[model samples]
Target: MEIKGLRKIEPYVAGSQPTGKNIIKLNTNENAYGPSLAVHQTLASFDAHQLRKYSTLDQAVLRQALSEQLGVPANQVIIGNGSDDILSMAFLAFFNSAEEVLFPDLTYGFYKVWADLYHIPFREVPLSSSFEIDSQDYLVENGGIVLTNPNAPTGIYKPLDQIEEIVKA
Candidate 1:
């Protein structure tokens, strides 16, 4: 049986994993320094007995802490396993085939994949000459916009006022 939205979907090419000891693996999509000391401490203190059951669905404690730190309501937070899971959920929840989603031509790369998977059409607006995301590029009519703040690869960021302009447009 043919899957819907399967046609024209190019397989995602992941970064290369070169195997070797003493080799500096630079292609990783993760932080150069692995988990922090805080993460290690949390893992060490975790209750092994809790492994027998599912984690709490609400993550109340984590959400409360994050809410306090971010000064936002706990209800505004929605934690997930990782960014991929969160992005997948956002794509499925917010976008549809009716109109195209807008994103940068050079970005996290997963945006296109997520759009395709959800059967949502997407348009890629090219960055400026210096590989900077001009907020004006996203002002066109569209269903929704997705972008990486402090854009990847180039690491250029748009100022808050420019971002506000994009949002208002």
Candidate 2:
């Protein structure tokens, strides 16, 4: 059986893994320093017995901790598996199918994937010749906007003033 939206999606391809012994693996953005001592201690102290039963899905403790640390309300702090998970959830929750979402031509590819999977129309605004995102370009009418701060591979970051301009428009 064929699905309607599946046909349009070009599955994302990750960078190839390094094969040779001297290769410096740059794919997946894994941490070079590995887990910290605090992380190791936390893992060592984890209560393995808790794994036997299902825990509540509410992340109030984590949310509260993050809120205190970040100086934001617990309601505003959402803990997720990763940035991708948070972005995916936000996109699905906030974007409307009737309107178009806007994003840069070169950004985290998953933004398009999420839009496609949710049947949310999205428009890709091209980056400038220097691979920088012009906030003015995003001022156009759009249902939602997703932008990478220090845009991927190119690493061009928009200043706060420019970001404010986009939000104000």
Tell me, by lDDT, which candidate is best: 1
TM-score on alpha carbons, each prediction: 0.83, 0.86
Which pairs clash in the backbone of model 2?
none
Listing every candidate in turn, what is its Cα RMSD in Å to the true structure after a full C-alpha superposition? 2.7, 2.5
lDDT of 1 by residue, 94-161 (tens): 88657789998988888888887677989999988989998777888898999777887678888888
**Model 2 lDDT per residue over 1-169, tens place:** 6787556666767666877765556556766677999999999999989899965577888888999999999999877879879988999899975768999988878888888877889999898998889888898888988887888867888898898898888
Candidate 1's C-alpha runs over 4 A off are 1-8, 23-42
Question: Which lDDT values do the candidates have, in the order given?
Answer: 0.85, 0.83
Evaluated at residue 117, the lDDT of candidate 2 is: 78
User: Given candidate 2, what's the lDDT at residue 115?
Assistant: 88
Question: Which window of ten consecutive residues has the lowest lDDT sum in model 2?
Answer: 21-30
Collision pairs in model 1: none
What lDDT score goes with residue 103 in model 1?
Answer: 90
